[model samples]
Target: MTTKVLICLYENEVCPRFDLTREVLIAVIDRDAAVLKEKEVVLPQASLEMLCQMILTEGIQVVICGGIEEEYYQYLKWKNVKVLDSVIGDCKLVLQRLVQGRLKSGDILVE
Candidate 1:
């Protein structure tokens, strides 16, 4: 099964807060965990509602972000989007771990 993952970004790094993020990296990975496609999305503004809408509309199965509020976190989970929050690292590194099934919530990859 292929999975679509979204990563909130800020200047090549994971955004510090999900609600305040304006840019995101989206990737499509196949069952074998190979990334088939990837792109960056720049939102007009930072809004959690918009983010949620994007996730639902784009069929995102997983969301990797940093410092999400409890409400939004639960909301995403309720929507069936796996939320990996509080991840600190380069976006590339985060995506690598995600594809390897090693990324976890609250993971800090930066030393």
Candidate 2:
């Protein structure tokens, strides 16, 4: 099974803002607790259909993002993928907290 987190960002890496109108970076991990491979996805739209394609194509499980809209969040929840929103700070830190199961729902760094 694959357990992973996808961070929505404008740039290929994490920045101050996710730039909701742009692409998102995908951080993936396999069965092991190590970062397997990292890739970027320039999603056509932040719609549920695009998300479904990402999951089905890449086998992702979680989405650790800076910001997320209500519809996308709902879609992810209904699709059985964990969605961690309002997350900030170091991009890697967010992912680490998630990997260790120490992430909080509303624990986000405000800019």
Candidate 3:
């Protein structure tokens, strides 16, 4: 089994669209300490209520987004899932560092 993670990718700064809620892109590493390919899954935002169920029911461990609504953030935290704020950059690298335990949440992303 691999430790799961979820990262948010956007074309620009802000979340452009809701339907564009693309995959739960995460970096899955095996026991060998090697990096593997990433995976993306399309998720649906049926509504606020549904989002909660989706996460708990889907076994999502972490959520990464450019910026999430404060309200939802609280809900996620309550569920015990790691929530990262103000993450910006190549979603893949961010997830990589996070999985490797090198990335610190809330650290500004610099080019």
- Predicted model with the maximum TM-score: 1
lDDT by residue for model 2 (17-63), tens = 33343566677665556777777777676565665567656656776
Candidate 1 segments whose C-alpha is farther than 4 A from its true place: none
Local distance difference test, each candidate: 0.94, 0.64, 0.59
Which is better, 2 or 3, measured by lDDT? 2
The TM-score obtained by model 3 is 0.68
Q: What is the clash tally of candidate 3? A: 1
Clash list (residue pairs), candidate 1? none
Candidate 1 structure quality by residue, lDDT tens digits, 1-111:
899999999999999999999999999988787999999999999998899999999999999999988998898899999999999999999998898999999899984
User: Which lDDT tens digits does candidate 3 get at residues 2-84?
Assistant: 65566655642313222245445644565455546566655564244554566677566776666567778888889887777
Q: How much RMSD separates candidate 3 from the native structure?
A: 3.7
Candidate ranking under lDDT, highest first, comes to 1, 2, 3
